[model samples]
Target chain A: MREVAALAGVSVKTVSRVVNQEAGVSSAVRERVSSAVSRLDYRPNLAASNLRRAGARTGLIGALVQDLSNSFSAGVLRALEDTARAHRTGVLATSLDEGVERERELVHDLVTRRVDGLVIMPASTRHDYLVSELRTGTPAVFVDRPPRGVDADSVVVDNASGARSGTEHLLARGHRRIAGLFHLTQIVTVQHRIDGFRSAHEAFGLVPDPRLVVTDISSAEEATRVVDRLLALDDPPTAIFAARNLLATGAVRSLAQHGLRRSVALVGFDDFPLADLLDPPLTVVRQDVARIGRTVGELIFQRIDGDTSPPRHVVIEPTLVVRGSGEIRPTA
Target chain B: MREVAALAGVSVKTVSRVVNQEAGVSSAVRERVSSAVSRLDYRPNLAASNLRRAGARTGLIGALVQDLSNSFSAGVLRALEDTARAHRTGVLATSLDEGVERERELVHDLVTRRVDGLVIMPASTRHDYLVSELRTGTPAVFVDRPPRGVDADSVVVDNASGARSGTEHLLARGHRRIAGLFHLTQIVTVQHRIDGFRSAHEAFGLVPDPRLVVTDISSAEEATRVVDRLLALDDPPTAIFAARNLLATGAVRSLAQHGLRRSVALVGFDDFPLADLLDPPLTVVRQDVARIGRTVGELIFQRIDGDTSPPRHVVIEPTLVVRGSGEIRPTA
Candidate 1:
């Protein structure tokens, strides 16, 4: 500011008034100061200025997801970023990697940076730790899961219903023995999906074989191993309902390797890019990730804009996309 | 500081000394001040302190990529974020969306935020605008594309050679009429891939059909339309070399729709996650995106850590991964 004032041959206060667009600065002096500012390439410290001004925005938000590399999380982040960009706000994205401690740490870090708002796909079961931050007026919107032990806006898919519909689709296809592959049951979403899978069997008045239900499948590779084990069983499942995208990928690989792509019915939860291009075109219970992300973006921005409304929970209904795979009939 | 002092029954200067970790602060006073600070959840604004201290890091960096939703960009971002996390730095990632103006605006915004460093997959043809920022001591490393009109460290895959290898692999499989699908010709990487396509045909003592060489292809849908038009040609190419991943996806869709998945050979430049799972399994010139990301991360952090050497350019060699599509014989 001093350098700009000196270059413009004006007082530092005059330069400040020009920079801040304050009234009472003459056109000639304002032009001179502006030219000097441009020439000097001076960027006023927004972080510092934002500190002094109440209700000043930082023009940046933080998005914490389970994993940025995963298709679902990446898609959600992309949607949030697009929405944020429309408001001229940038997003700082980080992956929690399903670490509860990491989520807390990252939330703390983003809070320390004073992000205008937050969009979190939380790994932690409870978000009580965020109460103080919420109380202090840093609004946050949770995605993919509801916040436990705290009041916050959230957008989540109807995971249990989506899973039930997918399982029911396979059962209606006359597949008597259906296998279920899932992520860790500790995750609320995963547990909800498991509940849906069980409810579908109950609706059909058929008991799901406990031996065919596999959990704790974290990666596609792990899912593949689980599928291989199930396939080798004496009473192998005639169909598979993968409750996660990665698990679905594993099931696809296993079915392909076993030359059973045409015989075994399969349905996956969570649609991914190229799902339609896969052999038999993967059948999926598709959650509108883009919509979920947009909802989260909207909720967080509203809070940032000082909307003092009570927290709202939004549950998006997932749709069944019947591609070739789920339509496959049992050969037995 | 005053609030902490009041809570801890200490002088403001004593709290400041403890927070700054300056010498001459008694451990008892420091412990009392720290407890009070924790009790109040008083986060010392690092942004404000960073402005006052020379060489103080904001513990944040900026990453500007083409798009976050795309597999390549997302993979790179995930790797970079992992590396930055190890260094206790957060990355604020933004997508350029192939807009030069957006790139400039985002760069200026990141600069204004006083990020410690930057990693850019540049959209602009000329980056003389970044010269000022670089001169101002904000380190940046370019990725996927090299920086132009300015000196900066860059990590890029061998585009020309990668394209050439993919084309040659098709030619070796008795494909005389090969279609070349590429991105925008203005992009340096796309242009280099086109050059490689032409050179490979030249090496084989053949001239590529002008009608078969398509450019300006952006999305999978566009690529599919282009492929449909090419297939409608009376003299259609037997093989396709898709220079971009989306173009490959389009080509795959077209072939599948036309019931030519078994007969039409196709090779893609960049490999995607589901490439191997597609019908006929996509053959590709695979650039190690993870490695490229890691290389970019290392270079940028090194620059941020005061490595003032001349700008270094790193080129990674791409490898050919033959699944099934590229090995198909041209049955004219």
Candidate 2:
């Protein structure tokens, strides 16, 4: 700690504050201390002490997600919470809302507050900033998306396969004008889904019309607006593939508004709670949320239990939930 | 700290461990130390130190709710998170899952970890257990329901009034036989909603059919089963009042399955995302979740800012969101 302080030109207490995740330290000082620590390969003694307390843990884990209210994130969180509770641990859950700065700040807060581990749904494009915290032996399991610029344990569904299957389903239904609705982020999962969308078209010797694919939606409300615009086009899409749950819901609304729900087919990526109860019962590429969450919980706890193994990446396959909405044949 | 250790017949480090929320202390030791703490009214010096760091405070707050996966709870959590982030505070969120023991334990964990404050949607019947934490200068504000067996700041929507309005809407729709689908728990919020259901019937000089009011539903799936049974009854209800969001969704499913959605009127208690996009567009009693969450956030932050004022209770009234489903005319 003293060496890190000297190297960073800060007091020993400042280094301790940075390492412990306490507030009051300026971002610049935190950066300097973190750089110095990384340069010196400093691992906090506290993490070493944590490894020794095999049976006893802080009884708390942090769950950082894009949005806790979203069905996909919520389902994963519930599964993790149930697993943590069985072990008498409480989750310190927070939503990042896709803000890069917010994710960094909250991660710092959760660590400073001293959680046993973390299950992160990273919003930040890169996670190398967390290298110091990870090296200090804080077990982190990324969920829904793989970690960027830093290696860690992660649990994600096969986004590409899921998207391919949904698109294939639409193609099999003989829908030629299939529109792809996707979120705006450059997130790997979203990109993979878009790739799947295009690849499905290519495999069948059909080129996807760039105009039919709408991307860069920020919210479900935005999805509705984008879907409305797509429907307004002279050559409207006969089938729609929504890459996210909220986007799917938005497509449903737009289709309903345009009186096209029964005429145009739709497929969603993630299945939500009442998707089956929708007007036409939404067809979705369902990621086994409970299993994904369980995988994440297992990996995080395994590391907490002193596992020094190399980081593991688990990708669960997505299954197609064939409900009525996606089964709608494109009308002539 | 010395006195607490002495009184509890534990070492000072054990007491420190308990106070600092560190692991390694057994539950028995924790209980004894907590008891000693309560008996001696011991306030950890850390909390005092927290007060001195007023401007540079702990950028963490605890948010305890029933289930973060539930739409209502998730919405509340999101609202609180938005507000907290605006103030540079991170939420240490958790799900209580309707377990009293779990709520107590999680609360203990959050308090001992020294969050700036808390916003709780409590599962515990009584919150007198939290008197010590509150007394120790941790600001707490309850949401969705008022604290029982204790006086504290609270922000709750008038559940009874909202439910009554929904029931009355159905009554005014010329429905004589109305079924009430309710959740099992004796949660005050649920009870208030039930009371509203009954009072609405009484106002019209009618006796509610006990057989039609099916309660004890534990899950959204259970809500489906209960609604199915209600429909199976001889002279089934002409309309249904679902006292919760999940129950409402279940009721919609049941109605859809029975091919009676257009004929049977239904009104749900709490509004959920995409409620307006349902087949007939569900009419619901809207709780103004954003307002409620914002109010809770404001109160807790005020208390954290060293407001030693008397506890305040804020009750927001709910409004009926009338859509197609709830406005259905009874099939005579």
Candidate 3:
């Protein structure tokens, strides 16, 4: 800092102000400080600067996950841990269980601890408070789903494309009556997947039959009931496409109970543990969770580094991994 | 603090000195400060005290996990996350991959971040550096396995008891020959389970028969080969105990492939997803992962509270969850 100040022909306080990006510094002084900083290869001692204030870096990055029990969330969290470790920062992980008050409390506590940044999966529809917090120079990025009612960096799966491709694969295999099972979460990601599924059905010149669609089943058990009803239909679908792993588990169980594994072709979104090891291996669209997490971590770090141009959202596409279930020729 | 000093009939500096437990303070003065603290319900804010110094709560806890992919670590990490969230603290998690340099770097990074406490599942044979760090008033506790060459609070499962119970259950079902399949982690927990299995066989006046024991198999594929070799033997064991979930997966696959699911009995140490829905439900010795995690969290928090008492070790007992697979009565 002293070398920069000397080279810039300015007082130490002026150089400090310029480096910290304080508003009072004149444009000319800022330019001089920037040039001098470049010339000296001066890297500001961030820890020292933070120590001058009560709120220090805590060297922690707060990660607010939606649910820990979900395999997707766990995988993403692990990836984030790896990224944070590389930056010499540690993660402070909290699960909100989709509660608004819990999210608020978590955010406030993390702020009080002065974490370096946050990677949050917001559950609530109203994210204006988060927007305000971001506007005040706090770096944050949303994952799994985009931030609603706010502008920020986001990392999400190309759910619509994934669903379309999955449904199209079923259609290409001569299956017209395909049931789509999904959870009732009001997140934009789920909406995109549903839209994609609809698009694929329309492309095949088929109506999006309401009877073949199931929603509002919050758990695998309820999903099992939905599957039971679908298979019990007079013209039961020749195939099923579960929109998530838990629903897929339910579908698999339903098929196994009725000994229909040899008849119905099953395709699921999101690959899960033991998916391939099943009696008739499951075919599903697998998301690159680790890559998505790593991308979000990098974006958040860039955002924190004053890379403030515009909010960016990156969507990685999912790939279909065919094992056996999806490749089954429907014997309808 | 001023009020406390007044109530204790001491100067504010004297109160501070007593609170910090500086050696210069007299016992009488310490007693007075203690009484004043109790009366005022005053909790000294370490953050405030460390304004010009280094030690402070940092409001962060570090968790060092051996392998995130392992079910045991995942369960414990989830439980620790829940407990840490309730305490309004954040947990920084990292996977060691059992690398000594990685562990050292992780420990250094966590200490540099000034985390209030640590919950570690050691990766190396010894971590004396961690011991030195803890000795400087940094609180730490071990989980799954204790740190080598140091004494500290540790929380682990009763591996021996669980293994012994499982082995005895198999013996009681009139199975004369039993095989043990273990992973290649070379961890103490694994050794304990092997010992317990041996003890059970010895109690029944049966030899362990080296041919029946298979080691150095970590993944499902490797375990499948080991199980195949055991099953191919002229005098194959009537039953097997897989030491972990992946091994259990292998055992299930091998048993199913050989059409031996109904004839051969098997019990696994850790539970896997969808174990109950297999051809025959798997029996497992289930560890209380959540309980063990909560215990470790509490121990670390207590240490962070400046409890300089002797180190304590906690062992949580495992339960035998009997299912269809282990109850297959061997026929003569």
Q: lDDT: which candidate is best?
A: 1
What tens-digit string does per-residue lDDT give for candidate 1 at A1-332?
88999999999889878888999999999999999998998877777778778777878899999888899998899889988998889898999989999989888878877788989899989899999776656899999999998999999999999999999999998998999998988899999999999999999998899999999999999998899999999989999999999899988998889888878889999999899998899999999989988888889888888898999999999999988999988876
Q: Write the per-residue lDDT of candidate 1 for residues B144-169, one digit (tens) a residue.
A: 99889999999999999999999999
User: Model 2: runs farther than 4 Å from truth?
Assistant: A1-57, B1-58
Q: Provide the lDDT at B54 for model 2.
A: 41
lDDT per residue as tens, model 2, B1-332: 79999999999889878987998889999999999976775544422335444454656798998888888888888888788878877777788778889788777767656678988899877898887666546788999989987778999999888989999999998999999988865788888888899999999998899998877776777887788888888898889999989889988888888988888888998898778878789999999888888888888888888898999999999999988898888887
Query: What digit string (tens of lDDT, one per residue) describes model 3 on residues B176-215?
Result: 8888998664678888899889899988998788899887
What is the DockQ score of candidate 2, to 2 decimals?
0.20
Q: Which digits, one per residue and each the tens of the lDDT, describe model 2 over residues A1-332?
A: 78888999999889878987999999999999999987775645432334344544656798898888788888898889878877777687788778889788777666655677989999877898787666546789999889987879999999999999999999998999999998864788889999999899988889888998888887788999998998889998999999999899988988888888888999999998878878888999999988888888889888888898888999999999999988998888
Predictions ranked by TM-score, top down?
A: 1, 2, 3
TM-score pick, better of 2 and 3: 2
Q: Per-chain TM-score of chain B, candidate 3?
A: 0.81
lDDT for position A83 in model 3 = 82
DockQ of each: 0.72, 0.20, 0.13
Q: Give the candidate order by descending lDDT.
A: 1, 2, 3
